[model samples]
Target: MMILVYGGSGSGKSAFAEKKITELNKSGIPLYYLATMQVYDAEDEERIKRHRMQRAGKGFTTIEQPKDLGNIALELREAKSDILLECMSNVVANEMFSDAISDPSIYDKKVSEEKSFDKYEGVFNKIKDEIIKLKDSCNNLIIVSNNVFEDGNIYDDETMKYIKTLGDINVFLAEISDEVWEVVAGIPVRIK
Candidate 1:
C-alpha cells in the first residue's frame, strides 16, 4: 500500500508521516527510512539533524539516497520491508538542480549566467519512475511531500515549473495511493 502525507511548510507533516509509518510496521520486518535530502547549507544540516533526532530509536535503517533510488539494490531485493520515503520535494529539488548546485564555479556564476531550466518534464518523469520502483520493492510505502501550490505569489518561469511538477506528482501519487492525508497545523486530515 502507498500512503502520501503532505502539508504546507512547518505543518508537522514529517512527524505525522513518521508516526504513521512506524505504526504500520507491525510485522517486525526491516523498516527502511529512505531519506532523500541533500545538505546544502548549515540550516539544512540542522534540519537533517533534527529529523534524525526525531526518528532515533524508531527501528529504521536509514539509507541516504539523495537522487538515485537504485543505490540500495541489495535492500530492495533481499527482503520485503516497509519503506518511508522521508520527502519527495527534496528528491525533486535534488534531481532538478543538484548539478548546478554542485558545480565548482557555482558561487561565481549568477542566475543569468547559467543555462535555462529545461528539465522539468524529464525530472518529473524520473521522479515518477523512482516512486513506481519504490512501490514495487516495499510492502508499505509512505511518502512525505510538501503542499506547495497554495501560496498566492506569482513566481518566475523556473519556480513555476518546479511548482507544477510537484503538483502533478501529488496528483499522480494520490490517484494510486491507498491513503492520502493532508496535514494542517499538526493535524492529519484524510483526503482520500
Candidate 2:
C-alpha cells in the first residue's frame, strides 16, 4: 500500500503521516522512518530535534538517507519494512541543487537563464525512479511532502525551479498512491 500525505509548512502533515503509519502496522511489520532532511544551520538542527521528539517511542528504526532513495531500497531489500518518508520537498531540493551534479557552473548558468525545464528533466526522472524503487522494496510506503506552491510570493529562478520540480513530484506521487490526503490546520482531508 502506498499513501501520500501533503500540506503546507506547519500544517500537521508529518504528524498525520506518522499516526497513519502506526495505525497501519497492526501486523507488527518492521517500521522504518526515512528522514531526508539535512541540517545546515541551527534552525535545521532544532527542527530535526523536534521531529525526533515527536516520533520518539514510535517503534521506528530511523534511516538517514538524505539523498538517493534507491540506495535505501538496496539497503532494506530484505527487511520488508513499512516505510514513512518524512518529507519529499527536502529530497527534491537535495537532488536538484546538490554540489555533486556534473559541471556545477554550467548547471547554475542554465538554471539562471531559465532556458528550458529539460535541464531538470534528468533530476525529475531520477527522483521519480528512485521513489518507485524504494516503494517496491518496502511492504508499505507512506510519504510525507510539503505543499509549497500555494504561497503567492515570487522567488528567484533557482528557487522557482525547485518549487516547480517538487510540485511535479508531488503530482506523480498522488497519481501512483493508493491513498492521498491533504492536511489542513491539523486535519487530514482525503483527496484520493
Instruction: Score every model by TM-score.
Output: 0.90, 0.91
lDDT of 1 by residue, 1-192 (tens): 889999989999999999999899976688999888888799999999999999999998998988877555345856778989878888877877777678847524635565454567788887788778778877888989898888788997667877888888889899889999999999999999
Error of 1 at 151 (Å): 1.5
Tens-place lDDT digits, model 2, residues 75-189: 8889788999989998998887665354679676755674677757878899999998998898989999998897798998778988989989999999999999999999999
Model 1: residue 175 alpha-carbon error in angstroms: 1.1
RMSD per model, one decimal: 2.4, 2.6
lDDT of 1 at 171: 90
